[model samples]
Target: MSSATHRTAEEIGRTATGPRPVPPLGEQRFAADLSHVDTELSNGLRVLAVRKATVPLVELRVWIPFAGTDVLHPATAEVLAETLLTGTARRDRIAVDTELALIGGDLGAGVDPERLILNGTTLASGLPTMLDVLGDVFTGASYADAEVARERERLIERIAVSRTQPRTIAREALQKQRYGDHPAVREVPRAEDVAVVEPEQVRALHTASVLPRGSVLVIVGDIDPETIIGDLEKALGGWASDATAARLPALPELSGGNVLLVPRSGAVQSQLRLSAQTVPRTHPRYAAVQMANLVFGGYFSSRLVENIREDKGYTYSAHSGFEFTDQNAVVNIDADTANDATAAALLETRYELGRLGMVPPTAEEVESVRQYAIGSLVTATSSQTGLAGQLTALAATGLGPEWLAEHPARLAEVTAEEVAQAALDYFAPKRFSGVVVGDAELLAPKLTALGDVTVGAPAE
Candidate 1:
C-alpha cells in the first residue's frame, strides 16, 4: 500500500533464509569415475557401452548411417529415421506410441549433424521388450508412401514457419553466404526438394545410411555391456550390406568474407548471425578453441553475456558455439537486438572478440568456467536418454563410446594461454560472415556503415 511497505517486503524477499549455492565461477570439473569406456561390437554394428549404476534406467541410441548423406539425399535419412518410429510391421503409428505410453517407456529417433539416431529409455527390466520393438522398426519398418508424403508436407510447413523466426532465418542466411559454393552450406533442406521424394527414395536412402554402411549402437545404464553386445551380435549378425553406393559431398571452402542482411519491414528486432569454418574435434587447437568459446559465448556467464546483457542490457541473449560434422567444421554466433541498436550491437561483439584474444582471463574466471563445463559432464550419464544420444552420436562421428570419459581431462588440460590463442586465431572479425534479419531496407544502411553489407532478396 505504501512505498516504504513495498520496499520492506522486497528487501525481506531478497534476504536469504539459508546459504544457497552461488553458481561456480567458471566451467567446473566433471566427476564420476570415467575409467571404463567399454567398446566392442557384434556383426557389422558397432557397440559403445558405458556403465552408470546411479540409476535403474538404461538409454539406448541405435544409429543407422542410412540417413543417406552417402546417397546425396540430404534430410531423407532424417525423414526415414522419423518414419520408422511412426509404424512397424506389427503396429501402426497409434499402436506404437500407445505401447510406449502404457509402459512408461520413451522411445523415438531423430537425425542430428552426423547420424540418424534411434533412441529410447526405460527401466532395466524392460530392455528386452524395448529392444525387440526397436529391432522391428529398425529392421522392418513399413515406409509407406502415404507416411512419407505426410512427413514431407510437415517439413515444408516447418520451413515456412522457420522463415518468420529472425534468428533461425539469419543463421541459414549466414550459412549460405559462407559456403557460397559448398554443399555443406545447405542448412535447411529446400522445401521443393521434399515434394520430389517418394517412398522408394526414402527406402534407398535408408538402405545406404541407416542400414549400416557406417553405423553404431551405444548403450548406457544398468545392463551388462558384454551380454548386451552378445545379444546384439546375434540379432544383427545376419544383416549384410544394402550394397547402396555412397560418396562424400565435398565440404565447402570459406568464400572471401561477405555480410548479408534480410529485411523485415516495420520490425522491432533484428537477428544477427556469424559463421566461419572451424577446427575439427581432433584438431590440436580443438580443446583450446572450445575453452575460449566457453569464455566468450558458450556459457551463460561468458563475455557475451557480460557485455551484451549484463553491461548494456542490449539483449537477453547473445552467445556462440561450434559444431563439427564429418565433412566440415562450423562456428556460429547469434544475438537479437532492437533494430536501431543492431549494428551497434555488432560493433560491441567485435570488440569483445578482440578482447577475448588480447586479454588474459582472471584466475577466478577460468575456474568458474571449468566448474560449469565439467560438472555438467558428470551428470550427463545420469540421464539414460542423454547418454544414449551422446554415445550414438559419438560413434557416428568415428569417436569411441567412451568419448565422454575423456572430456574432463581433455578440457582440464586447456590453459588460459591456449584459450587466448584460439580466440585470436578463430574469432577474427575480418573473417566474420553475417546475416541480419530485420527490416533490411531500413536496417541495411545502418549496417553498411558499420561494415561491408549486402541486402539479400526480400522473403516471400
Candidate 2:
C-alpha cells in the first residue's frame, strides 16, 4: 500500500502536462504602403520600381496576359522567352551563360493560368548590362527551329516525370477534374502538341502577344527611381504601341456531389481533392470564406490538420483551402497515410466539414486566426517582388490594390455564423474526388466503404 501510494517520478513525468505553447501566426495589414513607384514609358510600357536600398539585389518581372488559355498561342511566346536567354541573337546559350556570369545574372520566363511573365534578378550595379540582355531576348530574338525542337523534347520528359509524382499527379488530376481538359487546366503540352509548334509559330506569337501595349515591368533594387525609369523608357520607347486586348476564356462552373477515384498499385497513402465554386476576389463573402478556411484547414492548428494529421497521425500533413481564379474555384486537400487509415482519415474530413456549418469557431479561435491570418498577409506580400507578382494576378482578373486593401476589414468583420454558412454553401465532402497512387490492390479493399474504386493504370 505504501509503495503504491508513492507515485514514481517516471510515472509523474509521463503524465506531465502544462499549457501548450500557441503557434505563430500573422496579422492583417498592407505591406507596401510605405512607398509606391510606377511609371509609363514613351512606348506605352508601364514600369513599376521599388527601391529596397538595403539590399544590393534587384528583381524584374515583366507581365503579358497571354496564358495557354488562348488557343492560338498556347505557351508559344512563353516558351520562346525561356530559350531566348539560352541562346542570343549575338551568341549561343553557352556564350549567353558565360556573359551572364561576368555580372552574376540570369533570365527565365513562365506562363501561369492568367499571365505570361518574364522574371529575373541581378545585382543593383548589374542592371545596365541586364537591361541589354532583356531587350535582346524580347525585341531581337532569333528563334532557330533547332532550339525549339530541343526544348520540346525536354518538355516531353517533364510531362512523363510528372505522372509518377503522387502529389503532382493528384494536383494536375484535380485541376483536370475542376476545369475539364480545357487548355487552362492542361499545362503539359503533349508530344504531339509540341511537334505542332514550329519556330515560325513561336516567332509569330511573340510579335503578336509580347508587346508593350498591355505589359507592366517591375524593377526592384537599390537605384534612383527617376534615373532607372528614364533608362527603361529609352529601351522600350520604340516598341510597338498596338495593344491587342486578350479576353480570358470563360471557366466552367464548379459543381459538387461526386467521387472520382484514380487508383494506383503499391499504395501506402491516399490523396483527396474537395472542390466547390467559390467567390472571386470581388465577392463580399471573400473575407468570411478566407476566415472560414482558416478555421477549417489553412493552418496547422486548423480543424482538419489537428484532427486528421496531428491528433490521429493519419498523415504527415492534412490541409485544405480555396484557390481564387477568374471564375469560381475548388478547394483541395492532399495527404498520404497508411492504406488502412484512409477511411478513418476521410471520415474525419467529413466530420470536420459537418462541424464547420455546425459549431462554428469561438471568438477566441476567430480572433487568434484573424491576427495570424492578417499578420501572415503582410509578410507574404512584403517584398517588392511579392507586390509585383500580385499586380499581374489581380490585373488578369479585373481586380487590383483597391480590392486587396478592403480585405482585412472584411476578414475582421466575419463571425462564426458566416463561416458556418460558407461551409454549408461551399464544402461538398460527399462528392469529393480521391486519387490514390500506390499499391491499389492492397489499398482499395480497405477503402471499400468510401465509394466504388476505379483502378488507374499507367499511361503508356
Candidate 3:
C-alpha cells in the first residue's frame, strides 16, 4: 500500500478511452390505472377514494374553501385552525389524542388566505374511528376560552418573529406590489389583531366558514374504493349545511412593469423575487410551457443555475417554478445573493430571460427536461401519501385522478418547437415584475442604473 503504488483520484476516474459516455434514458413507463371512486356524499362533500394497498396505512386530505372578507377574518381564522382539533363535545384535547393514539392515527388542521386543509393518517382498520372523530369536531367542537387564550398568545409571538424575517418581508412587499389590495395579499395577520380575537369570534368563524358543500376529501391506501364511499357516507352523515364554502375572488392578471426596490437598512444579503402570469394546467400548451420552465430554472441543471450559481458563484441557490391558484397559474423566479452581488445577479437573470426567448432550448435540452418531467411525475405518484396529495391538488381545481394518469403522455407529446414557442411567449423579461429587498442606499444607484427599477421607502 505504498503511495507510489496507488493511482491518483484523477487517474482512477479517467480511462484510456477518455471519460465515459452518458447512457440514454430507457423507455418511459406510464402510471397504471388505479381503481377509485369519485362521488358526492349526501352531506355535499365530494369524496375520492383509491385502493393502493401498498401498506396498512391510509392517508387523508380535506380541502375546504375558506375565504373571507371581514377585517378580522385572518386573525379569527388563525385562532380557529389552532383550536379546531383541541376539543369536541364528547372529547376534550387529551381524550381526542388518546382515542387517535389507540388506533395509530393523528389529525391536524391549517389555514391560509385561500383554503383550510386537514391532513390525517391512520391504520386502514381505524378508518371508521378516524371519520367519527372528524365528524365529532365538525358538528360540535367547543372552542374553550382557555384554549383560545393560550393559542392566541403563542400565535402572536410567532407572528412577531416571522414578520421580522427577510423572506417574510420580501413576500409581503411582493404581494402588495403585484396584486394591489387583493385579499390574497393578507397572508400573515397582525399581532394586534390576534390579541383582540375573542374566543366567541373564533367559534363563530368556524361555524360560518368551515362548510362541506364546496370541499373535497381524498383518501388513498389499503381499502376497497366502492365500500369506502358507503363508509364515508355513514361517518360524515350528520355534518351537513345548506351554505356553500367561501371561495377567494379571482386575482387580477399580472403584467410586466418596473421592479420595486424595498430598502432593508444595513442588510448583509438580498432577496430577488420575480413573477409573471402563465397558463393553467388544463390549457393545451401547458405541457410545452412546463418543459420550457424546466430548461429555464425549474431544476438543478437549468440554464439560470448554471450561469449564476456554478459559473459565476453569485448565489448559493436559485430557482424558477409555477404557482397555481384556483384556475390560474404564474411562474416565479427567486434567488438569494450577497449584497455585493445583487446588481450583477439581477443583470444576469434578465439576460437569461431575454436569451431564452431569442435562442430557445435545443432538441437535446428538450428531451432531457421531457424525461425529467415524466420521471418526476411517475416517481412522485408511486406512494400512497404522494398520490393522495397530488389528487387533492388536482381536485381543488375541478380535476381528478384521471388528469394525473394522463399527464405523462402529454409531456411525451410536447415538441421542441412547441417548447421554444412557449419560452418566447411566456419567459420574456418584460412580462415580469418583482421586488428586491436590500439596503436601498447601496442597491439604488446600481439597480436604478440597470433601468426598469424604482426605489421605495425603507421596510418598517
Best TM-score among the predictions, by candidate number? 3
Please, what are the lDDT tens digits per residue for candidate 3 over residues 1-460? 9988999867877789986444665665433368999999998999999889889999999999999999889999999999999999899999999989988999999999999999999999998899999989988889999999999999999999999999999999888888988888889999999999998998899888888898999999998999998888888888899999999999999997789999999999999999999999999999999999999999999999999999999999999999987877999999999988999999999999999999999998999999889888888888888998899989999999889878888998999999999999999999999999999988999999999999987776
| Clash counts for the predictions, in order | 21, 17, 0
Please, what's the RMSD in Å of model 1?
4.3
Clashing pairs in 3: none
C-alpha TM-score for every candidate: 0.84, 0.82, 0.96
**Candidate lDDT (C-alpha), each:** 0.69, 0.68, 0.91
The worst-scoring run of ten residues by lDDT in candidate 2 lies at 451-460
Give lDDT tens digits, candidate 1, residues 399-443.
Answer: 764456677778788887777778888877776777878887678
* Model 1 error, position 189 (Å): 3.4
How far off is residue 83 in model 2, in Å?
1.1
What TM-score does prediction 1 earn?
A: 0.84
Q: Order the candidate numbers by lDDT, best to worst.
A: 3, 1, 2
Give per-residue CA lDDT, model 2, range 1-460, as digits (tens). 6886887656655533754445655443474443445667877677766565656877788877665544635546445655666665676777766666777776778765556777777777888778877777777677777888888677657766865777776666667666776667655445456556778888877776667766777776677767888778766665664665353577777655544556655656667656666677677777777777788888888889989888888888777776755554556666677777876776788788778777778777788778777777676567756766766566555555555466667777888777667767766465355455555666656555666445555322
lDDT value, candidate 2, whole model:
0.68
Q: Indicate whether candidate 1 or candidate 2 has the larger TM-score.
A: 1
Which of candidates 1 and 2 reaches a greater lDDT? 1
Report the lDDT of model 3 for residue 307: 96
